[model samples]
Target chain A: MIELDVTKSHVLHQWKADSPLIACRFSPTGDHCVSTSQDNRLQRWNIADGQKVVLEGHESWVHALTFNKTGDQLISGGCEGRLIWWSILEAQPKAIRSVEAHAGWIRGVEISPDGGMLVSVGNDQVIRLWKTDTGEKLHEWPAHERHIYSAAFHPDGQHLLTGDLLGKICVWKLSDRTLVRTLDAATLYSPNKGQNAEFGGVRSLAISPNGNEVYAAGTHKGSNPFGAVHEPLLLRFNWADGALTKSHVCDGIPGGLLYRAAALNDATLTAVSGGSSGGILLFFNATQEKEFHRAGLPSLARDMDIHPAKGLVATAHFDQHLRISALFA
Target chain B: MSNRARYACGSMDHALSRRRFLGASGLLGASGILGGVASLPSKVAGAIPKNDYRVVVFNMHGGLSQLESWDPKPSTNTGGPFRAIATSVPGIHISELLPKTAKQMHHLCLLRGVNTAEDDHGKGAYMMLTGRRQTPAAEYPQVGSVAAKMLHDDQTGLPGHIIITPGGGGGRGNEAAYLGPKFNSIHLGGDKPPQNSNKPDAIAQEAEERRHLLRRKINEQYLSQRRSAITDAYTHSYEQALKLMERREVFDVSKEPQAAQDKYGNSELGRQCLVARRLLENGVSFVQITHSNYDTHNDNFNFHIEQVGEFDLAYATFIEDLAERGMLEKTLVVVLSEFGRTPNINLYYGRDHWSKAWSVAMAGAKIVPGAAFGQTNKEGTEVVDGQVDHGDIFHTILRGVGVDSSQSLIVDGRELPIADPAAEPIWKVLV
Candidate 1:
């Protein structure tokens, strides 16, 4: 039996700061994790020693951050609607490129598979694709009539998947920025109330290792007067046609709000989701065709990263702590 | 303005003439004029007066089982537990639960074999409401939206279209769809009378004075911004809202006579139907009343019994009240659902989703009375003859209301037909 030790085995790392941290990510090498705080600073922390290397430039809170595929560069988006890219080389510790990307708050950002293109979506309801090397605008498409919450690049770098505030997911062909297909997320819910809940937009997206399947997780509130009951939904869509093939409900997953998800391998995945009540890490193995297994970590788990060379799962929580665990079977 | 000055203006003369005509015609209580005009020969189109017809579609949100409602198949095993009874019209029959409706069958033309492509509730609701299958590029407008688009009168002091107790089932496609929100039906969220109709006496006088001043301000602003389409649409909606606010009496069901309430029953569905009748009487082009909770996956018999009881009393009273008020002939009343239940009862003692052979009923307007349009199989599993799909039903409704069904909407440089390009209206139902 796999036993959980919350009292004695809990690992908590606390960094005292003046403001709350909104987003965090691990370096591709997993040696360090970068956190963006409401204090308008991006702190790079040594995973072993817990020392911080703080990078300060943004005038406002940093809302999102990510690393490029090769793990040689870091990019952060903020309320300033500008994308700041940093070189990971030891000699250059500052941002290498800063591009004015959108007219509104940058809601999401993704790096292309080959690390050649960077895409950002925002409250402006527009998706801007850029050449990562020069920060030159490549193409732009008005993806939805409402705010876009999340976006991702296809594994082959030829297409893009995006979700809107209305709970609609669309597949776009990158060459001309044309909408190829749309997946109605409402179908995944119980058919009775599904139609009324279709407008609850997707908040997070993850692509499988082989790129054949893309998973979108969304949040919908019921229509009762007091307030809608928040439910987190996971949908798997065919990467090529954007056809929604299957759906699973992560009902009441520690945190009612799902903030981030990532594919751990071809068949295994992990998600970080929660709200005011706090969050937990959820693990699922698509290869086994079994129910999702909860990893039982206690905190407001916000984002997660998986080691490329090893099977280590690292999660960042709002409580200013990090938990690293390995899958056991 | 002085009364004499108002009279000196020709507008008062027109108002007086209209009022006199209305009084002489007994408050337009006779439906013969409207129905006669709809059924007039096409060559005499120019001779018919304007603003004569109205349509009210009461959509049962889910598929109400045929065996428990309009077309009971008591002789077959698939019929379940309901028994059939004869209607006032010779040789016509309806479920026993609808005793009141059976007595008013002379005004109903039940279409017994309607079919559609989708079985899922979301897609099926879209198909039934919009009369078109779901497509990627465009969404077709609902029948009410189309009717409002074609028949709305700028001078009319009421909403061109309205939907009562909406959001029961299906998506927001129940509105205008591709026609955009401007043409979408103004939804009344619950069974309660509209908000404007609920003003207290103390606020009513003050509100009226403020409304007059606001109207003048709005007209001035609109006059200056006449060149913008957004401004135009806003002005149109504002003017319609003003007109609707002035006609609060139309939404006040309490003001209706006790006999009228008794005839329409005391349920929310009855009140909604009564409200639809009142709006139609006030020259509203289209009104839709949705009755929910028809999704009977289990306890199908007991559920339908209660549902049909409500429908039978409310629907029958609505038809009778309209006829007694002489509004039935001019208003087209349609009863439809997303689809029908399966012919066979499942192990759960419920009929599953079936789109193969269902029934819809039409009455009033230009429909021929005491008629059934098609036949179902012996076991009632499939359509045996005169099969009709969503498009056919669409064309039939448009035809009943005297609109050309062959028209098409142009979207993205593509011409999409209003009805199915391959289907035709059921000629037997129309005169």
Candidate 2:
């Protein structure tokens, strides 16, 4: 566990590598961290000393990396359209399963809480679900017309949520592989009167752990159609009814953006969101339910993962650094 | 008299005896002179057939600079890196960049001193296209919408107004404001003709039969509802769509000789212009075609060259085609840009935005050809003489099409002048 200064946020722990790091995740026990990079390598590191247990065999950039619920298996999906499963033994990090999953780049990969299922979404606009142990094809569904950016298995393991390039968010049923709901949550009205206005697309999506709410962000700048900036839109929706609960424009956020977010904690719920401008792990506490607490970090974070057991936050940043922050009560 | 009877009589009287009644009633015509005057008020309603002519606006979105194209000043510091060539019109010169347009300059009028309020793309587009500032409460309809409202014929069977590739890089400010969606221009998003717009094989064979059936069904529906406005609008749009579908053969450019296509170039912008010509030939009162990607803050020279080359060919071909078809006298072609680029090149060898002084070219209609309307300074930084803004330019275009720019539109419970209330058209350029 690392307790760094809250003020000197610029001090980031760097992970030296030959290629650019794309994704990072922490083990359930918070003892080991896994990183996937463009160099076509997945390195498992000891969280204490940062030593690497390099896993090889992938021929392209590992676009997505995920650890199963039990922390005994690592599943990686890549741009080359292959999904590979690795058995997590210290002596032998052996590939247990590999399959040709998609026609285009696989952008998203998620493992169910029970470790029984694996779900992946790709640029080919299809979402494929698989049985994690047997590599059996569970189902495939047409999710979006364009690229599917992110996908996740709901905590209950019975539903799937996916976001697409056209700013469409869809909820799919696992049993029937049917689209249960679609939300055009990024629809924006023209601020200037008399002009018909529309937004670009959705860039990222995150769901609350309780499955009560989901948030989506839009990709575009000012109200001006000619402006070349990507602004963030936070949409909160009721998961059960598929109704929009609240839509908030996260003010004070800059125009250009690139990053993803995740919900943290279970009881007194809060979320940690960060992006390209800089890593801002904002604490949206709902217990007493005040405003958000702005927690600042050094680099621009790309993707982040939370330790399922200890709530330790591990962030992958564009600065080629992976730093773990331990939350203190 | 019953309200329905009074309305029908008033319409008939207005339609049949307009000139005789206007002559007898004098300037402020009293209501008593009109029949059923007490029961039916003399309200200005429906498409009023004025002496107004039609305007076809070609919106070149990125600022088309004056020095590099229309108002070339070869001897000045801000002049084009190339030379200025003489046009078909004596004493008028344009940049060598526009060879084709130059030859056709005898049929054109250049406004060299146009300026706008904003330099930013969105604001500039809104201001230039709408002739009004952007507001949150009320949308000022585009010029096309206004013209359509004033000139659209209910029996015309085609959309009164049309916009080709209306919105893309710079979102459209080209919508009907308070007039609502019924008057909104049918936005054809791209150059290609609308998909499935042609009449289906079955519909073509049973055209007269279907029309009779539709007329009967509509009369039956109207008998119960007394001609609801929603139903009327729907019927109007449906008939317009059907009419356009039957005329799909007009949009096929392959009918044009290969030499014509070569002259227009095979670019999308060129194709859109060709389509615009077809639309005008088929009786669309107002058509606006937007050409985008003029925001050249980087690689200015290379970008301008490619853009101007395409524009020169397309515009020249459009003018020639219209003239050849004997449609030039009736169709007014206005080439306008939002603003112009800065006089000085930035560190990136690019020019930033500027709205101080620019140029717009017009041809056909009542506009006197081969005339330069205004002038800019030596450095091309400011308007030197006869400065014009959105209001003046709009008034000029309107007047060219015979529209009285002094007219008023009702807005916010008050009367608002149609053109900029303060500016007048450059009458010297109009025949």
Candidate 3:
């Protein structure tokens, strides 16, 4: 395995899309990748030859996308609240199963580590669990007062954590479907009274590979919520006690939002931020309060993901492009 | 004809009793009472007109997205996340975010091809409100001020031009320009009454009366030496202030029935709507309620969901109430913004300002109900037919309320067209 090196990272390949890309992910085999965009169709790109295939199903922008552990099937959630299961490996990539999952925009969909269950959260403030293969709902409940933005399952599979616009993290004990505890990441939320608006939220969440800590990323210090004038922030919490461990901040990026983040390893975390000024990729030590490495992108990025095995980073950008960068020279 | 009493009585059951006017002496300044006695218009004795037309303008401050409220382009790349829903008018649909407003579409007329060609916030607002582009050569009056000057009966106690803003401090807005402070908007910022509305305890009613009498004599002496429109406007503003105090109860939304308040909701926009209803019901000729912060450069979709959600409830309720009260026939209601948000969703999922093609909606008075006067392409990027501009909208608004937009107001012996003379009303959408 190649160790990730933030200092030596550089763009390796870039492919243009039909519209601004919302999210992207590498396949488990690391041979191909898929991306969701502002349009209804999803694009699958083969890493080797730059081959692209269109996976069509969603009626609106597909915001949430995830591949099952085996990479045979992919589930996508859209603004129209429809969830679709697609046969990604097939040449045509047909949508195998579709369900009306939520009442509003679906913000996130994550497959549990065991690959049997999928967790979805949406603007309706509800959390739902689904059978990955069948597209059948198992259990669902109103988990937050505000819109839930992201969700993550603990490595042990006993617990699930969800984050919302108010910067609240709820830990649900999966056995009884009960909330065990909540982690406070309030800095990620902003209630702008003058504008009569509430901006910011825990936009992205990730758990360490070893399950020792969890990271939440979003925006804070929003002086003008309507203008989207704010700063990017990343937070870490100790998994055992659920105590806030560190708050990582990037200075001087006014329109910044830590839109997506992923734990690269047990000790390192990477985040991509999009803003009025531009987009930035930042790397931080899990326990440290400062980001040690940073790189500016050509334009604003909406999402980012790590390679399944190789030291490569994939980012979906507003420039209507999907970028792949090698983390080591 | 009972002088201006028909207009003054409005829809209120309560009469403007002479005793009540005399008893409300301390609430106004001694000078205001004196000015009312000196400069009261001679036309106060004229017969009240049968059609006491009025206007209510909803300035959706910042830029409201045309796609989100009035003309949604669903399934298109620029349509954002919202879907289009059917409205009461056949073949008419609006964004799903405004479901309540959609139900009232039969009473509204849509102008989907408004191209103001100005995108800056201040400049855009100027064109929409004054019906003319911003130029250093001349300053024009806002529609509210023009409406007040044209439709208002001088004997009415309430100020003709009134504006309500959230968290706005009560005062006068300097929007009248050459129309003078007399026709300027008396701003009721927040839900509170006009600033310094209540009388101080130190000033006794009887003493205030004596002071008013003495000041009136001095004012007569001073006016005899120097009499001009500027002086008249100064004296008239004082009289307007006195009248405003006499009818200060009209500014209080708390006086509205609990059921009415509940129907309008309890949000700031809700309270402002209630106040607007009260002002209109009490015979104010022109009322402008500003619902703001729509300048969503970032997080446009989420912010609009919240902002337009609030507007949907309050606006629809206000329209329904006006119709129920039979005031809709006499009130020209318009919903306008400085500009519309761009169809292009930016990196922050927000929209920038776009003026090439957007929409504005108006209803009541002479406006043809359930009419869509213009058309945009499938993607809503540009207007394909029946294009109009700020000047056309301004003329249409005046024509709706029976004010001749083509006529010119003689200001200081100079002819100034009420609206832009180069542009005419959208006759296709008017009765």
Considering only chain A, what is the TM-score of each predicted structure?
Answer: 0.84, 0.82, 0.98
Candidate 2 docking band:
incorrect
Q: Write the per-residue lDDT of candidate 1 for residues B1-431, one digit (tens) a residue.
A: 11111110012323442453343233222211221222101121122223467778887765778877887876455766455789999888887778899999988999888878567665676777777786754556688876775666646777666877533221122245434344556666445555554445777777877987988797787678574333444566666666666777777788878888777777777888877887887788888887765655543554565567778888888898888888877788888887888877643235767898888999987889878888888778888888888878888887888877777655334455667778788888898
Cα lDDT of model 2 by residue, B225-335, tens digit: 775434544455556666776676666777667887777888777877877877776667788876654555533543465568778888898998888877888778998
Error of 1 at A49 (Å): 83
Q: In what order do the candidates fall by DockQ, top score first?
A: 3, 2, 1
**Each candidate: what lDDT?**
0.67, 0.65, 0.84
lDDT of 2 by residue, A1-329 (tens): 45422222232345655444567877777778888754567778777787778888675557688878888888888766799988864655888889999865687888887888888987688988888888899888777876687787778778888887657888888888788888765452112111112224444566778877776654444343223223445556677787876654455555433345566644332333343346655444333322255556676555567664564667765455677765543
Model 2: lDDT to the true structure: 0.65
Higher DockQ: candidate 2 or 3? 3
Question: Predictions ranked by lDDT, top down?
Answer: 3, 1, 2
Best by lDDT: 3
Assess the local accuracy of residue B78 in candidate 1 as a C-alpha lDDT between 0 and 100: 70
With a 3 Å backbone cut-off (N, CA, C), the pairs that clash in candidate 3 are B168-B189
Q: In terms of lDDT, which candidate is stronger, 2 or 3?
A: 3
Model 1 chain B poorest ten-residue lDDT run:
B1-10
Error of 3 at B305 (Å): 1.5
Q: Name the top TM-score candidate.
A: 3
TM-score of each: 0.49, 0.49, 0.90
